[model samples]
Target chain A: MAHKSAGRSALARVLAVLETFDQDNSALTVSRISKRSGLPVPTVYRIVAELLEMGLLERGSDRRLHVGVRLWEIASRAPRALGLREAAMPFMEDLHAATRQHTQLYVLEGCDALVIERLSTRSAVTNVTQVGDRQPLHATTGGLVLLAHASLHMQDSFLSAPMRAYTPNTPTDPAELRRILANIRTRGYVVCDGYITPDALGVGTPVYSPSGDVIAALSVVVPRDGAQPMTHVRALRLSSRGITDALGKPQVRHGPQNIRLFPFVNNEQL
Target chain B: MAHKSAGRSALARVLAVLETFDQDNSALTVSRISKRSGLPVPTVYRIVAELLEMGLLERGSDRRLHVGVRLWEIASRAPRALGLREAAMPFMEDLHAATRQHTQLYVLEGCDALVIERLSTRSAVTNVTQVGDRQPLHATTGGLVLLAHASLHMQDSFLSAPMRAYTPNTPTDPAELRRILANIRTRGYVVCDGYITPDALGVGTPVYSPSGDVIAALSVVVPRDGAQPMTHVRALRLSSRGITDALGKPQVRHGPQNIRLFPFVNNEQL
Candidate 1:
């Protein structure tokens, strides 16, 4: 369907080569990319060569290929990711400082919660959430907050799907999950004890927009051992409100702020 | 030269479309993309269709096209940007808190210092630096530190080029810049007063890797009004050391921490 519409398998081929490099497979050999992408070796080689020239891919001294910095520079302008991140950063900093844990801001993408921003310290617990990473809607506290506030159609579709059980405590049963979601929408926050991992407790609340729509989720993952999850719930709710207030402001810039380091001709272009 | 090499100029054409979206032109119409990229409208349609299918480009509610979340997700794997960002975030947070100003982490990309991470509050003085944004080597304090600690070959090549004079005070004379670079290397930090923007002062220091290579720079931009550039120097130097120490650590996870919100088979895959 994708091929017939665009009529350019070249784009597909390029995307296939790119799909080979994920978190674990960041650095890959040409042969490995060929095998993983299921593209012929020669095609992969040719595509890699083109990507290298375009600065979309780079080769390391170890002869491993990885995604290029140029690609990141372009993608950094993504409104949904970088835009939300720029808005939430200050509130997130306050939340992180107060909680001293793995604090994160997430946006609903597809059937998962895609983390747009995250703040962690060296001595923090084993909360592994990272920016640009996604978590299933049923397993994360932030995900549940998003799910609860999502449109009824989205909520129904998500609940009906067979959800993955992240941990034994992960509520996969649709009926049980529905009850949890409903509770979250009412309380405006949710605390999950050992939902994703046993050692961490997640507290999450929704970040709203000027139109009163739930635009994002704010949360903290703290160690479960002697941890007061309610304490973080208060902070998350407060920070989420701060983020909403910041977003509601008209003067707040979106995406990357246009910095004018050089006043030669045009500042916008640079 | 690029057109001749790709054989399939489709990659170059696709990149041209992607390049049409930037800080100012974050959202563009199909025709705008065609005009900006100088590609035929039909050719743009074909490329855009393919890009939309691959989730590399998204169409906004306003019917404008933008770089998509998927692109950001893929590019987030970039080691030079995201990896360094991961290691420096905590130290950056501490620096921001201590100074209560715009704290930033930058890496030398080409002849510019590319901002990898930044921390700021709403009331902080006008800090125009943004994540994934670039500041010219001669204009920014961070850029000067990177240039100072850079390899001799790089330094020589950069100095020989005819550089832009950002402001009247911007050091355009290569000999003057050479002296500044030398001073930075000797003093361990730099403070640029009214170099980039007239209202801001930037203080910077180098972050070193375990192998003693200068991997990144740490800096802050505070208002020039009663701005004690020397006061921020200590904070910046200490944070630079903290970032260097963090990077020097063997276990500092590259990119975003490998968040395991879902344990169904492979959390890394999700």
Candidate 2:
């Protein structure tokens, strides 16, 4: 739901109008946007007109409004998204080719793992994750890897909240998840068996920035039946190292003491 | 340069500040933004502050400003961008694997071809185009194919302009380019030898939308020496057809009469 407040700033209104369009509601009529955005019809009209003129929005053939390519062109330059994506792409391709499964790149955003890029095969195991889709931190292997390297405060708060169990194997209990996270940090990789889907198993490893901080997670999803998690983990580590090298940073062998509880505390606001 | 006219609306000002960021200038200081945007320091500061609060802009560790992940997250939902990309990615990956070269997707933006998606191997032939980079319509295979399907008015205006010749083989003559475009439409593909750069050959084909209009171009670039352009063309046509089917559009074999000069007139403004 949009932040429905009186006297919201013009910028806030525009953001709300833009936010009204998402994966499920990619296109909407003016009235639908006004209803979803909680902005008045006239206000929505003015904002839409301005946005359309600026090429931030486009009118579809059916007269519904969709986000414009111009906006995407501008936003594609964001270093936080495409910059990281560019660095990880080649390695991800290699992993995808080797595994013939779903290879994904993720970053922590709020309490969710935001998938930025995913390479999927036509016959790969079912993966609910799509690019730009967010999954709960406790329900996905990529999220667990990121959470393990997250700050203590974030982990504590996250573990304090009640999390949904996507499958019976999903780790939702705070104490058990804490142990699992600690294990992931020690192993430097995670193998999640049917945490998100009963038929899928995911192997995840951290991708470090030039500053030696965990900036993202690289993972591959394979069929849980007859899955060899360690084999996937080995492949993941190799690709993760490749991504780290591509980022102009050499892979640092982290001893137990070098593993910080808050490697990305400054990188993301928890 | 950003529009710096006085009394611009708040939307325009916000856009101006965002526009100041490009691939070349991803990170900027407040003063640099002010100078590039041509806005007063106080105004720029206020706008920047609001944007920072909304998470549209982020401060890097170096204290310089960068485009934030939140902005990219929202913009990633643009159907005009990721939607098309999602449909084209599998086919693009297949093309990349088969050719071990640069596989790209382009759409006509203004008088240029805007690359929305590109897949490249680490040791592939040199490709000047990057994702999000714009190439002159007459200088690259993707651009040429898109230009061929453009409306008559756009083609006329584009040919009337002084075009840049990236290489000696680049087509700069209006009459020659017109003939090339006609050949492309008739053959449903084009082979560009050393057009954008020496020692590279690009083969491009049109990707049709569900409406039967040319929505984008799919292309692959390989080394020129002993390159088989027909083989690449066949691969590109297959991938383009796959993308068209993925878009829920059954591929229609276009006769010369069915190929309208203004097929995309309603699709794009120019």
lDDT for each candidate structure = 0.77, 0.82
Tens-digit per-residue lDDT, A102-174, candidate 1: 8888877677888888898868887657777788889898789888877788888888878877668889999
- Candidate 1's C-alpha runs over 4 A off are A1-8, A151-157, A225-231, A252-270, B1-8, B149-157, B160-162, B225-234, B252-270
For model 1 chain A, give the 10-residue run with minimal summed lDDT.
Answer: A261-270
Chain B TM-score for all candidates, comma-separated:
0.85, 0.90
Docking class of 1: acceptable
Residue A81 error, candidate 1, Å: 0.5
Given candidate 2, what's the lDDT at residue A224?
A: 91
Clashing pairs in 2: none
